[model samples]
Target: MADQITGGCKCGKVRYAGTPLDAAPFRCHCRDCQQLTGSGHTEMMPLAREGFAISETCRIYEMQGGSGQSTYSGFCPDCGAQLIRRSARMGDRVYVHAGSLDDPAQYAPERSIYSDAAQPWDAGSIIKAD
Candidate 1:
């Protein structure tokens, strides 16, 4: 694991802690990520969906992606901060946006997914995934 990365939601309405090395981080430029995060890309860590637990209230909303796959996003009900995202097909894995971390710098883009959809400017923003 990279390190002990523990963080919570903006309002402390939710919390999550994990070993950074336990789940590799990844970056995605897919349209779904872009639309959901309101950013060009989403740099996040991938964890077993069950690995995360919340002490506060959270709500989940599921939507269909451009790829026609279901995408689920979990957010803190109080602050409405998107906390994590995962899909049924990728059920075992949940991707948490690095920005959601109390200390965003704790993680860097480990690998880039959907690179073809990535803007040229968003390229070269990756670290070793292994």
Candidate 2:
């Protein structure tokens, strides 16, 4: 784990790793994220898609965004926890949820993307996404 990132599903299935959370992390307030997480925002860390390594089998689901971007969200089929997500807009970055990690400090979000859709009840200070 010192050389790379490591985390897994709640049920201990669907593990993954990548470059250390050296890559800047951010929070996403996009509607897609709020809807996907059923929360105010998504604490995601963007990393190289190729750098991501999977251990257990995961469920890959595809969805087309209103922006005409295609995305494949990968998660644990058993626990139904999202581990990583990929899209056309982000060629190499795999926006991962910070909560998924054992120690989420490395993925601390520096900003939030798409604040226009953010819930009024959410009072986070991170920069909202455009």
Candidate 3:
């Protein structure tokens, strides 16, 4: 992976950069992710909070995750693009929305989470059928 990764939101607002690729990207299929994204799953890469920097204003939404811990979701104030998420499950780390990356293809997810809450069509295909 590249030494540095950078990206921003849809409207040129809420730009950010993360370094060192702290953790492998993963796909989340939890109902909260599905409902918030209106998609089957959401992809994210965990990085140290200190290594991440944002350039614009963001709206943060805090909610309780399935683990009963706080999950902070951030979005671009202008275009409503999802930017990042910080979960108590991973302290000192924040998960950046993979889709927000300039080259998201590099952050392929190696695992899937919250499979029990995945939709029927998505359940059987959480990971590729290798």
Candidate 4:
């Protein structure tokens, strides 16, 4: 396992490092994710609150999630690159945008959620059960 995983925003204004890369990622196909990513889905990897470190301040946006808990999104203020997400529904779990990783090829979504909200044209066989 990698000692730590590192990445940054498109503009390199916001950088982050998550230690002990032990978490599996998942794909979110919800409408909000699609809108945020401008794609069919977004890949997310969860890290402990302390496991992640940031280099600079990021702009945050919050909204009430489906679970009635506030979800916070952190992004680069300069280039508007989305970086992380944290939700009240998922206590202590700070989710990082997999796409922000320096090498996203090292990770893949273990499963997909909110498939019902997936766009009809968004079809793929990426998920594998284990």
By lDDT, the best candidate is 3
- Tens-place lDDT per residue, model 3, 25-61, is 7898889888888888899887778768877487889
lDDT of 4 by residue, 9-55 (tens): 99898999886345678888888888877889888977777767887
Q: Count clashes in each candidate, considering only residues at least 3 apart in sequence or on different chains.
A: 2, 4, 0, 0
What's the lDDT for candidate 2? 0.75
Provide the lDDT at 123 for model 1.
Answer: 64
lDDT of each: 0.72, 0.75, 0.83, 0.80
Query: What TM-score does structure 3 among the candidates reach?
Result: 0.90
Clashes in model 3: which pairs?
none
lDDT of 1 by residue, 16-109 (tens): 7655436557788887787777777887787655556656477888998666789888888888777788886776777777888867877766
- Best-performing candidate as measured by TM-score: 3
Model 2 — which ten-residue stretch has the worst lDDT?
Answer: 121-130
Query: Which should have the higher lDDT, number 1 or number 3?
Result: 3
- The parts of candidate 1 lying over 4 Å away from their true place are 2-5, 18-23, 120-130
Instruction: Kindly state the number of residue pairs that clash in model 4.
Output: 0
The root-mean-square deviation over C-alpha atoms between each candidate and the true structure, in angstroms, is 3.1, 2.7, 1.9, 1.8
Candidates, ranked, lDDT: 3, 4, 2, 1
For model 2, residues 35-80, the per-residue Cα lDDT tens digits are 7778887788776677678864888888996579998788898988
